[model samples]
Target: MATQREKDAADYLQKHQIMELFDNLTSMLFFYRPDNPREFLVEQLKQLKLSKQTGVNQQNLFNNSNLDAVIRILDPANQSYITYAQYKHALTTLGIKDINESPEGVHEDKISHETFKSEAIEGLQRCSSTYIKSDV
Candidate 1:
């Protein structure tokens, strides 16, 4: 629950509209065009206001089959050069004995074959460099 003070603060902020005011100020004049300056300015203001009021969800904004095919080609395999022993040794060396003691977590940052992650590739470089030395 929001505290009384928090509610009061939010109410005050709503009236002030600090973000809206800042947006207006920051976008006053970028360029003075040669042709129909006022019309261009009005259009620009309309676009800017609409964008600020309603932010775009860029991740789900695009849908292209060609792009998806390209991504599939570039995607990495879950299988790596790291031997099981190398993985075990690195974990042991890093004092991570309790790892895999429990069932593998569904929401873990670790990689699965089905759902690949860019972060996992970076982690493989950082935390398990020794294990990934061999090209298996």
Candidate 2:
């Protein structure tokens, strides 16, 4: 029931929305570091902020048992560093089938610098309400 132009516009919007989510998640996971940022420390996951309204308790999200299982799946080398590729693989292993396709239009293990920059700009635009000037 949609015209071709409207369908194209909707698709474009959805693509950009997914890209934004990917950019934000990547930034959070990698701590905004892009130099050799292919991997992240397991400890980083523990530092994520959780919302109480989500009803997901810390015991379930950050439990030692859960961490150990994830580590086993993501860090087979036991090196404590989980690569982006491994993380994606872990998601797939956990029944996440739509994990590989990235907003970049190709499957990639790590986010590029350009993507990070765009995400930063968008973050700044949304900062007035959520962040203080001093936080910058």
Candidate 3:
């Protein structure tokens, strides 16, 4: 049950083509050891810069021939755990012609929600025209 503000944020991210960017960042967090507070903090620092480095891809994801595969590639898009048919449905809806283009690029895609969230937040800031800035 997400709050209204949270839902709006998600919608904004999706509209800007940064959805996949956030997803990639979220997936990477799994590699860290949650039990170690120090390691957790260190990873957070490293992640702050990642989203910016990824930036929004210059090419439109929907327009690209690889979109369908990308939908499947994103681990979270499968609801953080999804079935193959769900992946197939996305490809079908996106009208992706080739089924196997390798969506490695689309893996982790989201804003890495956090107030101190820097790089990703900054990356989204640069592309602010896509959302947060758009409201202004």
By TM-score, who's the top model here?
Answer: 2
- Over 28-117, each residue of candidate 3 has an lDDT whose tens digit, in order, gives 344443677567545543544443455433222232234334444644454433334444454445433344323332244321212112
TM-score of each: 0.21, 0.25, 0.23
Q: Counting only residues 3 or more apart in sequence or on different chains, how many pairs clash (N, Cα, C under 3 Å) in candidate 2?
A: 0
- Candidates arranged by lDDT, highest first: 2, 3, 1
**Model 1 lDDT, full chain set:** 0.37
- Collision count for each candidate, in order: 0, 0, 10
- Top candidate by lDDT: 2
Question: Ranking by TM-score, best first?
Answer: 2, 3, 1
Worst 10 residues of 1 by lDDT: 127-136
Error of 1 at 63 (Å): 22
Compose the digit string of candidate 2's lDDT tens values, residues 1-136: 9999999997875654544334444554554454544444233333222312332322111233544666665556655455555554554543334443343412544433333233323333342111111111
Error of 3 at 108 (Å): 32
Q: lDDT tens digits, residues 33-128, model 1? A: 337657765665455455445542111111245323323443344242333333334334433334342222333433232222232233322332
Model 3 bad stretches (over 4 Å): 1-10, 15-22, 34-136
